[model samples]
Target chain A: MIVDLRRFLERRRPLWEELDRRLRAVEADPFARIGLDDIRRLHDLYEQVAADLADARELAVRTEVRDHLEALVARAYALVYALEETPARFRPLRWLAAELPQAVRRRARAGVTAAAAFGAGVLLGGAALLADPSARSHLMPFDHLQLHPAERVLAEERQMRAGGDLAGEQAGSFAAMLLVNNVRVSLLAAALGMTFGAGTLALLLYNGVVLGAVCVDFVVAGQTAFLAGWLLPHGSVEIPAILLGGQAGLVLASALLGDGDRRRRVDRLAAAGPDILSLLGGAAVLLVWAAGLEAFLSQYHEPILPYGLKIAIGLMQTAGLAAWLAFGGRWAGRPAP
Target chain B: MIHDGRWLEVETPEGVVFSLPLAGPVARFLAWQIDLAAIAAVATAIAYLTRWAWDLLPDTVAAVNYVAIFVVAAGYHMLLEWRWRGATIGKRALRLRVVDRRGLRLSPVQVVLRNLLRPVDQLPLFNLVGGVAMGLSRHAQRLGDLGANTVVVRVAPVPLPPVEHLTPPRYNSLRDRPHIEARLRRAVPPAAAVLAVRALLRRDEMDAAARVELFREMAAALRQWGALPPELTAGRSDEQIVRNVVDSYFRAPS
Candidate 1:
C-alpha cells in the first residue's frame, strides 16, 4: 500500500508518461516498421505499466490515477499481444491466383448449399412457367423482359443491322450502374446471413427464379441461340459471382450455428471472417468483369457478333473458370517429399 | 470478461483486470449522424470538383462519378476504422472507439464484416433494428457488432483529482492525535476516501447549500469513524474537518 500518494505519483509518473508517449507514436502511424529493440521495449513498458495498474488497484492511489494506468495498459496490451497478423503489403496477383480460390475451396460445402438453393428456385420457376405461363409477369420484373422473347430478339437483330447503337455513348454509364447494383446485391446477400441464412437463401432463390423464367421464355419462343449469345458472355461470370455471395452468406450462417464445433460463437465468427471477405472480394472482381462484358458485348446481336463465336467464348470462359477454382492453389505450399 | 451494467471488466492472461466503459446507444446514434453528414459533404464536394469533367465527357464522367460516390459511401467507415484502429470520423469526434470484445487488436476482417453487416442493422430505416439490439444486448452490441465480435467503448480521459489543494493546516488537531488518525484511515473505505477527495476537488461546481450539507454529512461520518475528542473538533468547520481528516489519512507518518 502507498503510504504517501504524492511520493508514489512522483516516482511512477515518469514511467507512465513514457509508456503513453510510445503508445501515441505507434498509434499515430499504423504502418511504421518498429525495430526489434523497440518492440521489446514496448513489451517491457506494457508489463511494467500493467504491474503498476495492479498496484494502483490495491487502493494505494486515487481512482483517477488507477484509471489512467488502466487505460495506458489497455492500449499497450492491444498492441503488444495482438492476435491478428500485422498488416502486410497486398499483392493482387498472388491473391487472385491463390488466396481467392483457396478461400472458395475452404467453404465448398457452403457453395454447394448455395447452388442447391438457387437450383431449387430454378426448378420451381420453370415448373410454374410451364404450368401456367401467366406467372411470367410475376417472375420477370424488368420491363424489357416483359417483351415476347422472339419479338425482342428480332428487334435487337434489326437494330444491329441498321447500325443503331444499343448502348451508344451511355455504355460506360450502364456498366458502372451494373457494377454498383450487382455489388450492392451481393453485399446484401452476405449481410443478411445474420438472419441465419433465411434472407440470403430467399435472395438467391429469387434471382434463380428470374433466370429460370427468362431462359424458359426464350426457349419456348424458339430464341435459344439468341438467349445463349446474349447472356453467356456475362452470365458465366456474373452468375457465379452471385452464387459466391450466397456462398459467403451460407458460410456466415454455418459459423453462427457452429453445429458440431465446440469453439465459442465469437471465435467461430472470427475464424470465418477472413474467408467471407475473400469470397465477397472475389465476387466483386468477377462482377466488374461481368459488367463490362454485359454492357459492351452481350448487348450486341447476331449481325454484329456471331452467336457461334459468342457461345464459344462463353464456353471457354466457363471451362477456364472451373479449372482455376478447382486447381488454382492446390500446390501452393506442398513440401518436396 | 464480465459485463457489469456499464463497464466491461476484462481479465488479462496475467490476471490483471481492467474495465472499459460501454458507449450508450444515444451517443452511438449521434456519432452515426455525424458520419452520415460527413459522407454527404464528401459526395457534394466530389460533385463540384468533377463538374468540369462532366462537361468534357459527360458519359465517362457520370460513370466515374457514380462509381466514386458508391465507393466512398461503401468504404468510408471500413477504411477509416481499419486505419484509425476502430475509430471513424464520428467516433473520434465523440471520443468513442470500437474495440474487440476480448480487448485484442481490431482485425481487418472484423472491420470489413462489421461494415458489410451495417445494412442488416439498418433494416427498415433509421437503425431501428440496431437500436433495439443495442438496448437489449448486455454489452450494447448491435448485430454487426455481434457478428464482428466487437463493442463500442467510451474512451473519455480521466482527470486526476487535485489532492494538493486539501493541504492540512500548520496546526492540525488530527495529526496531534495519531491514534485517531489511524482509526479514521482504517474505518474509512478507499472508495469513501476517494469520494471525499473528489467532493473537495469539485466543491466549486456544487450548489452553495448542497455543498454545505454534503461536507457536513462527510465530516460527521469522518468524526464518527475517527472518534476524535470534542476539544479537537470544537471550532473546525465541516469542510475544514473533512479536509483535515483526508490529509491526515493520505499523508505519510512523519
Candidate 2:
C-alpha cells in the first residue's frame, strides 16, 4: 500500500518531537521523578510513536524516516519496559551495617574456597622455606624481605633505641601508596574471575606464598615476637580484604561455570554482578583501614609502641571483623511491629 | 537474539522488533584511547595542584594526589556512564554507548561491574584479550562486557530525508493513469524503490558520472518492472523517470 509520505510525516512530527523531548529530560537526569500524569502521557506518546514506526515499516519504500522512528522506539522501549527496580539513594551507614556483610554472607561458599586457596599456598610456602633456606630468594622476592630476619629485628630495635622516626613524615604517603597498590590488586583479582576463577586463585595462592615465606623466615630466625608486632597490626585486616576480593572472583567464576544450574551464562553472570560488586567494595574499604594501620602503626617497634598493646589491638580488630561478617545483618530483613 | 555480526536484533514483549548496531573493536579501541587521554589530563592537573602545596605538607599533598589520581582513573568511566546513561567522554565523542544485551536500562551494578572488569580486558598488553573476545563473540562483546551482560552500540543519528524529495511532481504523467500507477506499485520490488529513493536523496554526494550511471541503471531496472508507457518515458531523463516511478509507487490516491 502506498502512503502519502509527506502528509504522514507532517501529521506525526509533533508526537515524535514531544516523545523525543520527554526522553531527553529523563535521560538528562536519570533520578528525576516523573508524576503519574507525566508517566501516563509519556506512555501514551510512546505507544503512538511505536504504532507510527510499525506503519512506516510497511511503506512502499524504505526511507530514513523509518530508521529515525526505529531509533525513537528503541530509546522509549528501554525506558518504558525496564524491568529492574529504580536504584535507591546511597546510604553509607546502611551499606556498611547491612548490605556489605549480607552480600558476603550470601556467598559463603566462594569465600571458603578463597580462604582455602590462600591457606594451602601459605603451607606450601612455609614448608618450601623450611626445607630449602637457599630458596628464600625465589620464595620472597621483595628486597626488604631479603634481609636476615634476626638482623632486621636487631636494626629495628636499634632504630627504636636511637629514637628514629621511621615513618614519621612519610606515613601519609605510605598509606596512600598501600591503598592504591592493594586496591588495584583486589580489583584485578575480582576482574580475573572472567578467567573462570583460575587467575583469581593463582593470585591468592601467590600472595599467600609470599606471606608464608615471610612469616617462616622470621619465625625460624627466632623473631616471632617482632614479626607478630609488625604484621598483625595490618595483615589481620589486609589479608581478609584480599581474600574477599578472591571470593568475589570465585563467585563470578561459579556463575560462569554454572555447574548444575540450567540458566544461560549471561543470566547467571547478571545475577552474580551485585554480589561481586558488594564484595569488592567491602574489600576496598577494609584495605583502606588496613593501609592506614600499616603505615601509621605497623612501622612502630617495641620502644615506641609496646608489642603487647599492638597484638591486642590486632586481635580485637580481627574479632570485630569476624563478628561483623557473621552477624552484622541478621535482623536487617525482620519486620517491624 | 539474532545477530548478523553488525546488528543485534531484540524483540520486545509487544512483538515489535528493533536492531541495534554493534560497535566494532576498532571504534571501541579508539574510544578507549580518548578516555585514557582524558584520565591522564585529569591526573596531570591534580599533580600540578598538589605541587603548590607540597612544601607545606609534602607527604599529605603527595598522598592526596595518589588517591585522587587513582579515583579519577577508576571512577571516570563508571561515574560518567552511570550519570550519562552509558556514555563516557570517549563514548560520546565516538557516538558509542554501552547498553544492556537485552536492550534494557543499564543498572548501576552493571555499570560498575563492566568498568571494574576493564583491567582484565587490558591484560597481556593493549587490549589483546578484549580484542580477541570481541572478534570471537557473536555480539562483539569483550570479556568485561560479557561479565556485565552489556554491549556497546553505535548511536550515530540517522537523518530523516526531506519530504520534498519524495513528493510526487505536480505535472507527473503517471498520476493521469490510476490503473498504471497501481500496477507500478505492485510490480516494482520494495528494494528497488528504496534504492531509487536513496539515490535521489544522496545524489549530490556522488560523483557526477557515477550518479548518472547509477540513476540510468536504476531507471532501466524500474522500467523493466514498472512497464510504463513509451510516451511517459520518451522525453524524461533517466533520473527524472526513476523519480516519477518512485513518486507513483509511494504517493496515495488523493
Candidate 3:
C-alpha cells in the first residue's frame, strides 16, 4: 500500500503541486467571486493531505508532526464556511485549523476541582520549603534514612531471602521498596501543585537545592566524586522526570488561580491530560533508572564527581530547556495557541 | 447571550456594547474577580521592578521597567485593536471584550477609566469576594466600567463570507464537490440557471459547505447577470470584494 501510494504521488506530483498552489491562492483570498475555484482548490488540498498522512504513517514519521498536519487539514474543513461567500473567510478558518489546544483547555476547565486540588498540593510543598530552614538538612521523612531506618530496609531484604534463595529474595525486596518509595515521591511532586504556581515551583526548587546541598555535604565528608559511579545509571532521566512532574503541577496550580483570560479558561482540570500523561511516563522511567543507580551504583560508595562538573551539567540541562522553550522546533514560527 | 428586547447602547472604538438587562450579584462578583486579577498582575510587576531597581539595575532599572510596562500596556491595546480592531489581544486571546452600552466600542475616556482604575478596582484582598459579585451582575461590569459608563461584553467576530451564485448539474454534498466538467451539459441559456441549480442543491449540503458553494456560484452568476462592478471582478473572488464592502460598515475609527 505504501509503495503504491508513493508511486501515485510521484506520478501526480506535478498536478498536485499545481492544485495545491491554486488552492493556496484561493485560501489566501477566499472571497466570493471565485468561490467555485476556491472550493476546487480546497478539494485538491484535502486529497493531497490525506495521501501524505497515509504514507507518512507507514514510514513512522514523528507523531507530533503528523498530528499537526492532519489537524491543519481538518481545521481547514471546519471554518471553510467563511470561504463560502467571501473566500476571504479562509484566513480565519485557516487560523482556527488546530483545535487540540482548545479541546485540551476545555477539558481542563471541566475538571476544575481536580486542578484546584493539585494547586493546593503545590502550595503546601512550596510553603514547607520556603518557610522551613531545616527542610534541606532534615530527612524528608520518606528518604533513605527515616523510612528505612539504620539498615532496617536492608534487614527486611534479608527476611525475604530466608524464605527462598537469599539473593533473589533480597533483590525482590529491594526492587519493591524502590518502586513503592518512588511512587510516593512522584505523587508528592504532582500534588504540590497548589498555592497558585508557587507551590510547584517550591517543590522543584527544594528538590534541586537539596540535591545541590547534599552533594556539597557528602563531598565535604570526603566521599569525593561520590556520584561518578553512584548515580550515573539513573539520575540522568530520574531527576529530570521529577522536575517535569513539578512543572506539570505548576501548570495545574496556575490554572486554578485563574490563569488566562475568560475565553482561554475553557476548562481547567482536564487540561492536564496530555501534560499529566507525559509527566507520568517520564517519571515512571526515571523511577526505574533511579532504582538501577541505587541498587547497582549507589551501593558502591565511589567518590563523587567534581562539584564543578555537576554544577556544569546542571547548568547545561537548564540551558537546553531554555533553548527548547525559546527556539524549539515544536512550534517553529507559529504563534503558540 | 440572548436578549429579547431593545436595550440601552453605548458606542466606542472597539465595538457596540449592550447594557446587560439588569445587574445581579453573581455577575458583579465575577467582574470584581476580573478586576482583582488585573490589579495583582500590575502590582506584582511593579513590586518586581522596585526590587530589581533596589538590587539589580541601580541607576535606571526602575525608570526603564516603568516606562516599558506603561508602553506595553497601551501598545498591546492599540496594536490588537488597530490590527484586529474587533478585539484586543487579551480580549481576543481570552475571548472577552469591552464595548459600548449597545455592543459598540468604549469611548476614549471609558478606555482610560477602565484601565487606569485597575489598582482600586482589583486589589486589597488575598481573596476575590468582590470579583465574584461583579460576575453575578447582568452587565458584567466592575466598579471601573460602571463608573466610566462602559460596558463589558462577550464578543463574536463577524464571519463575512462571499455571496456567490451557485452552479451545478447536481452534486452530492456527502461526496467531494465535482469540478466543472469542461464540457457543459449544454450551452444552455443564460449563466443564471446554472447558479440557480447550485444554490438549490446547496441548502442540502450543510451550513458551512453550502456557504462556500453559494459564494462561488454567486460571483459567476453575478458576472453572467452583468451586475458585478468591473474593478471587483478584475481578478479576485467576487465574494472577497463583496466582503470588504460589507466590513466597512463596522470598522473602528481612524
Q: Point to the candidate with the largest lDDT.
A: 2
What TM-score number comes out for model 2? Answer: 0.93
State candidate 1's TM-score: 0.92
lDDT of 2 by residue, A14-54 (tens): 89989989988997787787787877888888889888887
Q: What is the lDDT of residue A244 in candidate 2?
A: 95
Query: Mind sharing the TM-score for model 3?
Result: 0.29
Q: TM-score (chain B) for model 2?
A: 0.88
For residue A325, give model 3's deviation from the true position in Å. Answer: 9.4
lDDT of 1 by residue, A48-93 (tens): 8888888886554446677787788888888887622466566788
Q: Provide the lowest-lDDT 10-residue window in model 1 chain A.
A: A328-337
State each model's TM-score restricted to chain B. 0.86, 0.88, 0.38
For DockQ, candidate 2 versus 3, the one ahead is 2
Candidate 3, true inter-chain contacts retained: 0.00
Q: By DockQ, highest first, what's the ranking?
A: 2, 1, 3
What is the C-alpha lDDT profile of model 3 across A1-337, one tens digit per residue?
2322223334544544465456445434424255575567675565565565445454211232234333333333322432432211223332223222232233343234343443444455445545663564462433552332224323543543444332322443454456456644554555445345564555565555555544444443455444333344345545655655555455555555666635332244334433443444445555665665454434432122343455455455456533433343334243332
The lDDT for every candidate, in the order shown, is 0.86, 0.86, 0.42
Give the higher-lDDT candidate: 2 or 3. 2
User: Cα RMSDs of all predictions?
Assistant: 3.1, 3.0, 24.5
Show where candidate 3 strays beyond 4 Å. Answer: A1-169, A264-272, A301-337, B1-254
Find the 10 residues in a row with the least total lDDT in model 3 chain A.
A85-94
